[model samples]
Target chain A: MYDYSSRPSRLPLPVDERMASADIDLGQRKSIYRSLQELRQFEKRAHDLFLQNLVKGTTHLSLGMEAVAAGFGAAMRPDDYTFATYRGHAHALARGMEMGPAMAELLGRSNGVLGGKGGSMHLTDVSRGMMGSYAIIGAHLCIANGAAWSAQMRGSGQVTVCFFGDGTTNIGAFHEALNMAKVWQLPVVFVCENNLYMEYTPIDLITAVPHPAADRAASYGLESVIVDGNDPDAVYLAAGKAIGRAREGGGPALIEATTYRTGGHSRADPAKYRPLEEVEAWAQRDPIPMYHARLLGLGVAEGELSSIERDVAADVDAATEFAKAGEEPTGEALLTEVYADGSSRWRN
Target chain B: MAELTYREAVAAGIAQEMRRDPSLVMLGEDVAAAGGVFKTTVGLLDEFGPDRVRDTPISEQAILGAAMGASMTGVPVIAEIMFSDFLAVCWDMIANEIAKSRYMTDGQVSFPLVIRTANGGAARFGAQHSQSVENWAMMIPGLKVVAPSTPADTVALMAAAVRDPDPVIFFEHKSLFATKGEVPEVEVVGRLGEASIVREGSDATVAALALMVPRALEAADRLQQEEGISVEVIDVRSLVPLDTKTLLASVEKTSRLFTVEENPRLCGWGAELISIVGEEAFWNLDGPLVRITTPHIPLPAAASLEDLAIPSVDRIYETVKSSLR
Candidate 1:
């Protein structure tokens, strides 16, 4: 009975109105706010390091897209699995990974989370269940399905949450994973951070449908849910429903979060392609300022919010110093971990 | 000892490992109720049931991706890609994500999984279905490659590949599926990177793999009878963790080396072996190391063309007889 053509618009309600009606307790609210603050500080420091040529390779920053990661990270369980894309610093920090190791990894230091082998695009820490930050687009969705299938087979009751860009919706693996996940009723939640652009081009120009991910949900027998990516409360509520359903064996769900990246796609991109008016409009809706104002309006003291911001800044500064003091990887590091035996030797 | 076909040994090998390891699972298209397109996995669904033995859709990416994901997160898996050539459909997952994941993750995750596929030609399936592409996997650093010739080696190697705590690409030859050989009716586990000396001779070392092993043995028999050439035929089973010690010892004893390969002439597995022998056993060689391989071209579907395309018994005989002269 679901109508594909005449589907009603599901853009999230006004942020202040949703915050007033949100059922989240004060402690949870403070945690979400803190995560958002951490994400902002970490990314800004990364950008600064890149400018100073301390970070190597390329980095994809999730500047204005923190709510989607923060909201889901707060809602997910400690044992649950998280699969993220290259723009995954936010997701990694949100999952409670230490910022020092993550920053060291970006700097290609020996004390990195992956010992400087993975760099920025391939950050992985299995201990905290931040499975991996895959560089290849559309590949991790299918991998997420595998993790979910394992959970289902083991009767672990664990849910896997996979995050990707809106650009990934058009790729082959995305469709393949979606169809297979639905067919098997795997316990996974696919979140598409639709920033309205795929790299330099607007996604609407290349894609056939208006809502790339949510529109294709019905084809795979999934319910379409679009959330406000800038509002933590809205994202948290939508994520809770989807995660809860998946945990209770209700199959998989697809959530398309509409948001914008305040900066370019990567460090090299100047972002001159975006119009000035569009950029200004999106900057006005930045998640941090919106969440900060909402917290003050909800009878939380302004002093408390400022203190949280100060603490996050200090943490980012300490992490930067730690990364700077770390040594560069050398010698045996180049020829290790190619196989399970901890050596790269192919023959005797 | 019992005689079993190569395909039956595949099923027995998988069933044996699945019986021992409760965490192992299998997934692929037509792998469950259909018993696989090539029928290499018959009777598995009945023994293991639906949960363990799964029939997946025709999505190669999903099959490999799911297998990698599950293996990294605790459960070991054995996924089928139907045909070895179909690996191209999901090469990104196999080559990029699955192969390099452990190395890139700095050993944080391990993929203890097996990707078994029906490989090579002799049945006129054309170029799309028939390719001895073990070299493609050998070039990748993180994968372990295994291709067995006889029924016993199939079961033993399958056991090794399944138990190993790394990603292994198990290539089961389509041409050898119906061939039967003596298989011991007991628990048999073989080590990776070990070659079997199926024949012994003092004149020259002829290294072959998969279907070419049988052809090389037949050619060696013909050479000894008519041409008076004594050829040592070594089945170079595992390609990645290559058994170089056995190969080097054979080359040193024989003082001459020749490789029989079914892949294209350019950059085949034989090329790597020849390069190694040329480097390490340079003084041990009596003549130039020669590789008898199929020419670099798409395999034709016709019987005559296919026979000529793959290295045959006659081709192997003539190449060795003429090279030694």
Candidate 2:
């Protein structure tokens, strides 16, 4: 079992830990690392907005999961459909869903994505090809499968990236989706953010084989890779390559990211199921600090980094006020949106 | 008038439409080589070939999801769900996604997917297989739910479902398929969301849909002889784009309205019809609207229990009596 807490925790995220320690071309890696820092700062604001959106609803912030989104999101195009699970605010922010609207959506304001109907779990901005996030365990897999199949049929180079937690693999739709994606050579990247434990059940107990969960892909004759989820550059490089391969009709790939959720799955969860020593170990491997240290070693200025952090904090604070000030949707808006033309037979 | 079974008419209607519209495709579990579980897609695979006739894995969500995606383009896709009971699996994709897509997209995006599935109970297919989910589909606006009772009605309605520019759920009764009636072919295009007056009468109007149409017709005949009460039967082919004009006009003339449906009385088609009439033509109604339907219970698995779940001609006649009283 991988210990989550023994690892170091801080900003810039550690690219030195585990498999992410492998170096990339200095120039290219630096550019990705720089963009990642910017995205991190942007997401900090998103996290605050996410909290405000959850009017009693639970919001899972991607404080550690930012690397996976920032990295992969940088590599993908706006046309690409990004489907995600509940812990999706980071993914949404990376996909360009504004921090304010995203927060408004979370707060149940009508100005939010989905007009406040979806809250955090069902956030969708199809205009951005952010297909939508599903709250159901493993349900978005089917939606992505269908979306990818559609893209293949249309000859659209756009691929779909389906993000889910480690627990989603246990659901039947996971394998079914992969098999369908394989059979049709659909453009879809199945990203498994193996944040150690799925909610509270440790990966070892529920996962049967273990982390990476990449081994399961071979049964479908697809290549599977395990990446350092905490390392934004690593996640971005892997996602970029996999998404490119999928766009070229290279079929689907299962990329399992080995990382840890610093917090419990949802707001209310204490995560008592996780062993304290293990949590401390994974925390030591916190992606932010390790990456920030790497940037320092690379000679990036400490002053510039501090400035970026301040900017991010200001952005988040502004978004918080924006979301809070947004008006709630009237009760009329509820049934009004049920249909476009208001032609419900009952309404007649 | 040519005699045709509801199944034969449905198959003929789909075949004629496919022949007319080359872009139309039909795919489902057991719908290809197996000719559908009820043979509704019989000879369709041979006629349309592999491209048009496809057999999908038994994934309900996959089937509906694919159809929704395919319909985004000009390709008209008809997805058959073997049984309406299986709709529980993909209800989200259907209710939330498909039904809300067109309106949410500001009508720029139109999904012309027709989901064909066998619904209602007659065989001892148990709780898992037997369900009259027409009322369930009727709840959505962007999506239209069509039910064709007799062979003629089936032919007219299936073509209409295929031609509709919006998503349509075509529910075919497994029990009614073997029943035959006269059918006509008029260049394969039929008016969707239109009500058909199966039997015209003066005393009372019995508005029914799907399998309930025949039950209403039989009950009307029985009551005509036994109690000297004339019964008018109107088969409501489409549930969502309801032909309210025709339905209200029938009740306006007949004065009395009684609805018969296979679904349970609470929140079913019967309730919807009663509510619609109550809102539109409440004062025009000669008597209070009555609904004859199955009892609210998990469909019975046993033969007797299964038989007792849906409304029959006997129950329809009883409701007619109550409405007259």
The global C-alpha lDDT for each of the candidates, from Candidate 1 onward, is 0.93, 0.76
Clashing pairs in 1: none
Candidate 2: Cα lDDT at A301 = 84
Residue-by-residue lDDT tens digits, candidate 2, A1-348: 654433433222334444444455555555555555555565455555446544647777666666787777777887888888778877777787777777777777877766676777766667777766667676677768767766765677888898998888887778767776677677889899888677766665666675535978887788869988887767877988899889888988889987787677877776766667666767777767777777676677878666656666677677667777889878765564333344344322
lDDT of 1 by residue, A100-159 (tens): 999999999999999999999988888888999999999999999999999999999999
Best by DockQ: 1
Let me know the TM-score candidate 1 reaches against the reference structure: 0.98
lDDT of 1 by residue, B150-266 (tens): 999999999999999989999999999999999999987998999989999999999999999999999999999998999999999999899999999999999999999998999
**TM-score for every candidate vs. truth?**
0.98, 0.86
Q: What are the fnat scores of the candidates, in the order listed?
A: 0.79, 0.16
